[model samples]
Target: MKKDLIYSLPVLLATACSDDAEPQSNNIQCIHPGEDLQAYYDLLTQNPQVVAAMNLCERPASFQTLLWDKVREAEKTGLPPDAPKPQSYYDFGLEMETKSLSGVSFDSNQYQKIEMVENAEYDFYFPAKDGEGRKLIISNQVLERATETFLRNQEEREPIKTIYTTKEEAQEIYAAHLAHSLWIEKNEKVPWSIIDYNSEQLGELFGTRTWFKTWDEKNDEYVISLVLDHSPRETWKVINDIVDLEDLTDQKAGVRGSAGYRYSE
Candidate 1:
């Protein structure tokens, strides 16, 4: 659960709340990892948990601290008897990756392994993708730990019948999930303040109200619903690539035009 940190826009600060009640540091600039940091990216590629903690982190140190906290929690809960608890981020990552890969019942040769370094080999290996659709690169872990927890909680319950969930409930869950992700990744305490969004410019996100169209099994008809236009990370990546390509093409065109011209001809 997120802390109820009240954050209003700069314009509304005066009328919305008393000056004494306002929290300090309303706006803060965050530094993201750069593309040139090959060593840092390599470390992240090896550690999936670290990557999860880094998704929304403002500073690089925040993710390491988050991972350390998790390790401390695991220790307090009691690891297996005779199991050595990890003391650092590198140790914890290695231990978890090893534990996740143990007791595998299927052939692992079919899947691609994530390498620690392109030019060198490592002792441990993490799969690019598990049987499920989870990606080790972006996801916390490829094993779908969330599903595992859900199954464990429901183990003693009666056989499943109807699964019920509302759009409002889902929106709250979605927002909380993203909020938590930002906290874990970026170490941002308040969800709303994690990304300094211009509330006035974007207004409220009506997109939260959009829902997927579901098929009515009993009526045998397609249920029409408000559709959400997804702005996925892959979409932005493709957009950036397209922009780079266009710039390169323009440069080539300029070069060709210049080459065609001769001095005093």
Candidate 2:
């Protein structure tokens, strides 16, 4: 059977927050990693070896001289007096917007660029709010959710032969996908976690458990499980008992996967 994302690592790296920070709790909402990553930055600053090892800073100071020279040449040539102002997605929809040639203290990017959707007409539907399609440095959990969502929606949903067959290849591809998803964030107007696990519970609405299996070659057995919620077979048993003996209005449905919604505490 061609299965999708059942036992696979997500495109997002399943990165644990730095051990320096508190261990992440399962139910609590995760803080956006970049918003207040001062601790992470401090750790990197004290350890030059860690920075070099991670390659967090990709370029040397001199490398920008080439681009800077070109920019300086353009500066001497001066922009036309009637150069167009930066356009927002609000005005252009999905079409590309023009940017101001002259740098300013305030720019169009500061404003919200909302496009119409069925549920919410004024929605920033594009990746990366500025629409510059710039890349972001992201944490592992977000990357994993991004990857899993991507894999969950593909047409063929086949494992990449190179990655599936070799352990090293798998790690390389996983890292690349994490980086790619980060870049995708730069192109959009907002950022949020995939907010999955609810979909796992959605399965029981039809009297079926959503789970997947993988071969355990060393043990010579097949392992069956669900990623977000464990042992759907067991969870379904409880739901079945509830339906047989009790009225649901008096009892909150309890499931292991969903954090708290529609599931008991």
Candidate 3:
């Protein structure tokens, strides 16, 4: 059976903020600068990598470059001759008007681009209220929540394959997983320990817990016991009080696998 897997990673504070600066909390409201919304949408639609990276809600240097280039190109041709230039930074923000999930909503004028230090990597810039510069870097937690909300509304989701039966298939999943891990590390400055944990527990472990039903011919029937006979037998219901040993075993294996190195993470 085909399944859709979405892994959630923990959000970290951006590395660009100075030691003296306090990191923005998820509660802080960021006003979207009301930049070219259509253009920003176009940018994201055209670039799948950016979409995947946004799933992490942390922007890397390459993602920054892409945004800058998109805005630059727009300035060269799309903007009017008399349009005022952005003070010091590009006026790009996502106005996810009328879209929301959980307790999070992207009301108009309430979302801003995640800010980063100029020419710096894995860092964010949050200008003081009395100071002059870009004022907000969308909090990582807020961004992650927003991304989840936005992805749900999107018609076509980026479906990442989780369970593989062959080395070739496993390699593809590994490559994608590795790429995502590297992107998170580079942009969010997340440690490998956390990444590996999420990968194993949320990924392989969850897959194993649900794997039996996925391949079972009588998938809808209640699993009474594991039969060794090759022939199809009568299905029987199991006691509700029975402990899910399979789930426990999968968790143990996932924890064990995470303790050691894997092809990815």
Best candidate according to TM-score: 1
The residue-by-residue lDDT of candidate 2 on 1-265, one tens digit each, is: 2111122112121122121223233221211123133243343344333323222232122221221222233233432111111122112221213211111112355533333222232333123233575543434454345334434432246321210112222222222222222222222212322122142232222111222143233354332232212222234344454443232332233232223334532
Question: What does candidate 1's lDDT look like per residue over 57-124, in tens digits?
Answer: 22123432332333333234432111111122122222344322222222367545554332233323
Best-fitting candidate, measured by lDDT?
1
Q: Which candidate order results from sorting by TM-score in descending order?
A: 1, 2, 3
Instruction: State, as a TM-score between 0 and 1, how close model 1 is to the true structure.
Output: 0.18
- Estimate every model's Cα lDDT from 0 to 1: 0.31, 0.27, 0.29
Cα error, candidate 1, residue 146 (Å)? 39
Q: Which regions in candidate 3 have their CA more than 4 angstroms from the true location?
A: 1-166, 189-265
Query: For model 1, where is the 10-residue window of minimal lDDT?
Result: 80-89
lDDT of 3 by residue, 194-232 (tens): 233433343442231222223222232222123211111
Error of 3 at 260 (Å): 34
Q: Between candidates 1 and 3, which one is better according to TM-score?
A: 1
Candidate 1 vs candidate 2: which has greater TM-score?
1
User: How do the predictions measure up, each by TM-score?
Assistant: 0.18, 0.17, 0.15
Q: 113 in model 3: Cα distance from truth in Å?
A: 59
Candidate 2 vs candidate 3: which has greater lDDT?
A: 3
Ranking by lDDT: 1, 3, 2
